[model samples]
Target: MSDEPLRIVHCFRSPVGGIFRHVRDLAEAQTSAGHLVGIVCDSSTGGVHEDRLFEAIAPFLALGVTRTPMQRHIGFGDLAAARRTLGILHRMKADVLHGHGAKGGVYARLFGTSMRLGGRRVARLYSPHGGSLHYDPRTMTGRMFFALERMMERFGDGVLFVSDHERRTFINKIGEPRGRTTLVYNGLRDEEFVPVEAMQDAADFLYIGMMRDLKGPDLFIDALADTSRTTRLPVSAAMVGAGDDLPRYREQVRLLGLSDHVRFFDPMPARDAFRLARHVVVPSRAEAMPYIVLEALAATKPMIASMVGGIPEIFDEWRHGLVRPTVEQIAQKMREALDDPIQFAGLMPPAESLRARFSAGVMATAIERTYREALRRHS
Candidate 1:
């Protein structure tokens, strides 16, 4: 193997949420190491903010960004999507095709196989990121998706799981991966570790994530109401995000008569949203090493998050702050945080511990090692 810089392309459907954040961080780190990185994702996913993010990361991507209509479901559309993605990868001569989530995984693995058939070598990798893993195996759709997942494993050069729990889910649901896989944790930058001072009139709590039900935005609203009623305190919250389910959540807040108590904002930087509230709540119904958890913890902000996916992994020894993704549990936790901010803050692990475990530098180094190993095998 040579020490020359590698050309990398990340294929994923939507350029939003945690996956987008993960790719951006990885691209920056890889670029700093003199690697050529690029992104291929859905163009229809985001608004102005996403366009800005694309521009910010454009400097690192030698292949530039390739945006096409990559849908969320399995349909005839996938054939065309795969072709577009494959064409882009061939053009980039990508040494590594790293796919994020389900659609991205399908595109990357299939495209890698196509390249191999055309006498080109590429290391194909998939990171589940709680995509298809959220499906119930007993359902027909789940069965079909899992079966497809099994078929795709053959096309993969390897898998890059974000957490051990995700790897376990793959084993339990889709059977053991036929080849190789590794657990690579998501991470954050150095500046994020500093303590954040809440705005003078910040809300009592913050909900910063996609405004979808899977993320438990409704649960956040319900918990806020329950926390208000139980503690008899005028609890206030700021929920920041955008999604298809946003209108429904907005209606819910209005129906609950909390239009004022629960303020809403378009999706912004997590740090900015963190400043609008004293504490952050990640009420995700499911996940695979959510970046929000790492972001909030890195900001030295006290948080109450669901004990699902790799969230508990982040807590590690500090389990007091983790809770079930439900209204009652979150409401109770909210009551505690509201009752005594100082006490709740004391429950979180120290900033130094989190910084050591989840830094972007460590994450990038491990991933680059994985890429090198996969390339060797591909060669």
Candidate 2:
């Protein structure tokens, strides 16, 4: 191998959600670190917002990007896309193949093994940023996904988990070798949080993320209904992000007579949404170190979140913010936060410190170290 900068190929299903942001940040950081970075993604299907967003971000980095007509869902198209990916990898001569999300992981393993078998020195790494493993095994789809994951282990050289809880849950579910996995937490750039002048008349609570069921948008509205019955503090809530469930959530808000108390905004740039409120609420049924939580912490905003996934790892006690298990508990915590502004202000410094530990720079260094280790093993 030459002493030239390591060439990396990053693969992801759709350039959306936390996975997209993570891959983008890593690619920018690697480019800055003097490495050659390239990205491979499914081509744009006209009118898809996520595809357009990906197209926008692709050209900003000092790397090449190749998009094939791959579908996210399993289909005949994906098989052809996999072959295209193999052809791209061969041409790029990538030293490392890094995959993000479920479809990306599948492609990386399938084609990466072919490269390895052909006596190419390419290494494979998969990052499952909280994929189907979060699904409860009581469902048939979840069980099948677990089995598929177990089968994929034979092809992957390393797996990067975004949270300790997720790593533990995955290891227990798939029985993968412990040595093959590493915990690489999701991180935020400092510019991700913009300070808003302490709004004297802003909304009392805010929720950011896709307006989907797993994100608990409906439960948040239900909690607001519960809070209004107990207190007449004139509380207001902001729900941000766009999803397939937006219409249903709007209907629920109207049914609960929360039309005046709750307002919905289409997803804006994240910093703009974070700066619009003082309190951030994460009522997700499941998560794996959501960037919104880290963003809230970076902005020194108080938070009330469900104690799920990697949330507990971010804050120890109520001093930083509150963590609970149910919608009722989330409402109680919000009420408490509204009552004690001084106590909430006391959480800022500690929260900032916690946020710094997971900055984008730290995440990039961890990933680069992993890439080097993978290369060494293959050598």
Candidate 3:
């Protein structure tokens, strides 16, 4: 491998949620380390909130940001999208094609392989980010995706997993990866470690993330209702983030008569959302080391999160405190936290511990080393 800076291009589908966060962190960190980085993602997904995020990182993207229409599922449209993506990658002259999710992984490996055929020495890397791994292997959709994952392994030089559970799920569902694999936990920045103080009129709880079922926004609402009824007291919350199911969640809150207590807001910075509530609740049904958990912990904000995916790994010794993603369980935990805030706060991992384990600097270094290794092997 050359000592010169590597030109890296990250390809992902949605420029929202954790995948986007991961890419932004990597792009900034990599750029600081003297590497040139770029981003390629779907243009049709994010709104003003995501636009703001892109603007913050645009200056660091040496290869620049490229967006195009990308369909969420397999279709004839993929052929056109893939061609466009391949063209973009070729033009960027990326030394490493790093894909962030299922769709991105497919594009990175396939497009990177196509480039290789034309005598390009690009290292193809894929990070699942709990994308297709969320499917059930027993179902037809799951089997099909797993099969594709197994096949795609051959086209990539390496697989990067954000959590151990993500890697295990891939092996259990699709069998052992044919290429090299690395487990790199998602990380947080130094400024993110600064605790966010609640406003004088902050809500009782905060649910920040996509307003979709998988993330358990519905469960959070039901738990809030359950908590209020059981305690015979009003419980207020702020739900942030945008999703297709936003209307459904709003309807759910109204139907449950929580319209007065629950407020919906547009997607904003996590720290900004954190200050709107005294406590955070992550009731995700599944995850791959969600950045929200790390962010909340680093911010020194007390929180209760479901034990799923790589969350257990994040919790580590504190994993015993995690609850299952259920209305009853989430409600019970909510009540517990509210009833005895001190005891609940004690369950949180120390900020110093989180900072030591999950930092943007560490994450970027490990990933850069992995890229170099892949390039060396391919060379």
User: Which candidate number would show the highest lDDT if scored against the true structure?
Assistant: 3
Model 3's number of clashes is 0
**TM-score comparison, 1 vs 2, better candidate:** 1
All candidates in order of TM-score, best leading = 3, 1, 2
The collision pairs in model 2 are none
Q: What value of lDDT does candidate 2 attain over all alpha carbons?
A: 0.78
Candidate with more favorable, higher lDDT: 1 or 2: 1
Question: Which run of 10 residues does model 2 get worst, by summed lDDT?
Answer: 44-53
- Compared with the true structure, model 3 gives a TM-score of 0.98
Report every candidate's CA lDDT. Answer: 0.89, 0.78, 0.92
Query: What does candidate 1 score on TM?
Result: 0.98
Task: Give candidate 2's error at residue 136 in angstroms.
Answer: 1.8
lDDT of 1 by residue, 1-379 (tens): 5578988999999999999999999999998988989899997789887889998889667778889888888889878877777777788888889999999998889888888888887888888888999999999999999999999999998888999999999899999899899888998899998788799999999999887888999999999989888888789999999999999998998998888898899988888888999999999999999999888888878999999999988999998889999899999999888888999999897879888888899999999999899888868
Ranking by lDDT: 3, 1, 2
Candidate 3 lDDT, tens digit per residue, 9-44?
999999999999999999999999889999999999
Clashing residue pairs found in predicted model 1: none
